[model samples]
Target chain A: MNPCNHHSVSIKEMQKLCVSLVPIFNHLQPTEMEKIVHATRSASYQRGEQIYGAGDTSAQLFIVHRGLVKIFRLSESGREQLIRLLEPGDFMGELALFSGSPFDHFAVAMEQTELCVMTREDLNAFIEQHPKISLRIMEEFSRRLERAEKLISCLTSEATEQRIAAYLVELADEHAANSFTLPMSKKDIASYLGTTPETVSRKLAEFQENGWIEQSGQRNITLLDRYALQNL
Target chain B: MNPCNHHSVSIKEMQKLCVSLVPIFNHLQPTEMEKIVHATRSASYQRGEQIYGAGDTSAQLFIVHRGLVKIFRLSESGREQLIRLLEPGDFMGELALFSGSPFDHFAVAMEQTELCVMTREDLNAFIEQHPKISLRIMEEFSRRLERAEKLISCLTSEATEQRIAAYLVELADEHAANSFTLPMSKKDIASYLGTTPETVSRKLAEFQENGWIEQSGQRNITLLDRYALQNL
Candidate 1:
């Protein structure tokens, strides 16, 4: 797919559509929405491109307009920790936008991606005019915090296999299917689960051997025994 | 210290003072703060009292007027996972306040604690009247998300000793002193650091042995070699 394929849609229409896709804007007035649409810019990124990095001042919030993005941090040993894999309609860099601080992590395109971007100043001005947006932003932040707390618990206490199973279950539930293709590579999954790829591979093979799951290809996984997987 | 010693300060005065301590309320006009102050109520709890629990419907936001609170979750085996140790001026239950959902964790008073509480309905009404508070809330949440992300990295990758060292550095910085009394017990500290109390005890002893820190009695700790602790 051409990274520049976003040219097919008029930038105005694309921005409107992207902004509409965000739940925070769902309650916004048409005029308010239009202001956001006007402020938003669309950008395309090739796979493996760094959209933003740690220490960079976050001037804008980016919504995954199309394709995928990975939010992560580099550890002292230079190992990457995958914070999350964001899909289309998911937004990032709100921390910087809200606090006017530099980003603490890095974001990279996992595939040829298109992003809807709006400057912090523009968004803040809009929020000032429509303070209700702050409420929505708070709600979104609350949801993210709850998720992060849960992730912390899992990372600190859960076993590697249990964490992997929990992640798979989450993916299946999120995709609304018993089978789905992994959005990124197993290496990324390993990083996200705080285990090495070898452990992830061995764990998956063990699950397959135990008839807990079926791996069709490198990325395709079917939850044949989700209940048992949960018990693991 | 008597938990009920808050009696010296009139409830009305305490309420206004509590409202003022919240940074989000700093920008509010006196009349606005008055509304919050009028709606706020004070509650006291003995150490080990459960403030709120997982699955409880969150009906209010709590500000620690005095003493400490532990926000945590429980594993299947009933082991606690400390999410945060909130001190005076820190707050919790905002997730329920913003999202109107059940709490995903539990909160307990770590000591004789006094909390300033405002019901969700009252707080939401105040927010509507002064929506700019939401921006501050968003900024606070943004700060929390950043901390949570760092915690995820530490929980997932950092060794117990390293995590302990990092946490001590954070405490020293937060208290603005090299030596301070621990707000929570060593067991709670172990839970927060994702280790056993035995491990925590052993680590502290090791730190003392290495002349990296000095412990007085059980809780007071003085960082003798903060730089060396950082390198650990």
Candidate 2:
């Protein structure tokens, strides 16, 4: 599939659609929405392309328009700590936009990805005019904080297999099916779970051997015994 | 010190002061501020008393008017992972206030603590009338997310000693003095750093042996060689 294929939709219309889809901008006044639509620019990155990096001062508000983006930070010990994964309709770059600080982490395109971009100045002006947008932004931040805190607990306390099990259950629920494709590679999953890629592979193999799950391909996973995995 | 001794100041006056001092309510119009002031309530918790618990549905915005509060989560493994220590003027409970969801963690008073709180409904009303407050809330969320991400990196990748050193340096900077009392107990610090209390004690002893720090008592710490700690 050609990632760039947008059919008959014009780029301008697509940009407006992307902005409208973002939770922060939803239900805005027609004119208020127009201000955002006018300011947003559509951009795309190829798989493996770096979108932003640590210490980048000019961070703009980016709404993931399509595909996947990886957010990670390089630790002092020279290991990458996966911070978050942004899927379509998710937004990032708020830290810099809100605090006027440089990026503390990095963002890369995990696959062919499109983003609806807005300069900090433009977004700030829009936010200033719309309290609803500000409220939405707070809600997004609150949700992310809750998830981050959970991840902290998982990283500090849960064993490798338990964490992996928890992750699979979460994914199965997200996909609403027993069989689903992994959203990320094993290496990325390991970084996110605070384990090594080898450990993730070993744990998955063990799970398969115990009839807890089945792996058809590198990314396709089937939860054969989700109850067992959940209870693990 | 008598935690309840507020001289002759009335509770209403104190509540108004607390709300005004919060960054989110700062710079509000007189009438707008009056709405929040009318809705704000003052409450206190004794040392070791829980302010809220995980799964609590009636979460209200809590501003630490005085004393320390500990925010932590009990993981599936039954280990306590300290998420943050809230000092005076810090606020929490946004998870419920913004999204109307239950809290995923618990908060307890480390000392006799005073709080300025507003119910989610009342706070929502005030926020609807004040765009400035919403923007400030978004900014606060952004700041906390950045810190949370940093903590995730520290917990997952940093050595216990390095994390401890970073915490000490942070406290020194916060206090603006090389000699200051520890804000929280060693056990709490250990939990925050994902280590055991014994390890924390051993590491502090090692730091003193290396002339990097001096602990006069259980809580008083003098950063004799802060530069060394920074370079650790």
Candidate 3:
């Protein structure tokens, strides 16, 4: 499955779509955004495609324009830990943009996905020519760093249940609704939460039994009582 | 006792001294480096002086022009963990600069010290005007991030004794010249290693008994057998 084919959008349409979708480009003058949009190459990956893996040379920064991408690492025992999920408008590979080292994790397509790719060197050149754009990029980097630190702090300090609740609330916020499809499978969610799939299943069942949430299927989850869920 | 006073240098000269000492500034063009030197302020701190504490709003990026500084944090029980020690060219405050958060850890003067301080906002503005400068700064941040990720991996995978040995080798690589004094006390080292002071003492004794290392007084450690130490 290819997102480009599924969406049936032409390259020109995709370029326009890219400019409208990414907030980072919104701050730029239309001319500058057009230059970037013209430079960006759109690519599609099928579900489970390895977009890039750990130790891959840091070459391109990727912005997800459609579908989902999971950034993760494999433990020695072959257990996967998802560090972050990239959605539409979300960028990955900034770490590579700054560092010349190989990537530390793998980014896999969680669904048929469309991405706009830009080389780090070209991006740096663009930034050098546009100080205001550079500042905006720095601001974006700062926000990501803060989020990573907060996640680290939570991982070190919060209980498993609290972390799960926090994850659900975060998912809800991202989707901007009381209900949405789980973007990844339970196993992936477990890895992201640093727990077992069984634990995630058990917790979801408990939340349902407690009337905090309702599940219509394996993927569909609705916060039946958000206030109660929050308190939990 | 203040290092600046001990050296009989004026504040302006002290700041000039740091401009030449720090490697991160070495890449700057001579005129730009001179501008930075002129803008920086020099300050002195006595041993045990708190340069900045965890949770304090970070205002300045600090470079240790002379003497030593220790970046550390306190555990829940008030135990101090020395995270990193700064030598002449070393700097701190990048985390706060990029994250816009309070200092995540405290920096204390390990000895009477002279420091070069620049306002974070001023530095950010300077970087905005000079994207090349920003690139260099990002390079520095990348190095720190690499070190941090490596430390995290070691903590998660290595045994306690292996960690101690690895830490000693790291210190030796950075500071020791055949022999060098431990910058912080055993208690601080223990906390940094996530162990007790008694355990640190015991481990040192064990290393000495095993002919892996030799200790002279409580401060100087000599790696008698580097291969054996590495194997451990």
lDDT of 3 at A26: 58
DockQ of 1: 0.63
What TM-score fits each model?
0.89, 0.89, 0.71
TM-score of chain A of 1: 0.87
Superposed Cα deviation of residue B105, candidate 1 (Å):
1.4
Tell me the fnat of candidate 2. 0.72
Taking chain A of model 2 alone, its TM-score versus the true chain A equals 0.88
Question: Could you give candidate 2's per-residue lDDT for residues B1-232 as a string of tens digits?
Answer: 1124343455458555575356667776655555666667667789989988888876578888888899999986678888898987788998888777888889999898888777877766776676666767777888888888888888777777898999899899989999999877888788887789999999999999999998996899999998898778
Residue ranges of candidate 2 with Cα displaced over 4 Å: A1-20, B1-20, B227-232
Clashing pairs in 1: none
Worst 10 residues of 1 chain A by lDDT: A1-10
Residue-wise lDDT of candidate 3 within A1-232, one digit each (tens)? 1223323445568666585346665556666666676557678898889888888876677888888998777665566667668888878776666666788778989898888877777777877877556555555655555465445444434455767877888789989998988878898777666677898899989999998989997898888777776665
Alpha-carbon local distance difference test for all models: 0.80, 0.80, 0.70
* Runs in model 1 lying further than 4 Å from the true structure: A1-11, A14-17, B1-17
Residue pairs clashing, model 2: none
- DockQ for candidate 2, please give it: 0.66
TM-score of 1: 0.89
* Shift in Å, residue B13, candidate 2: 1.5
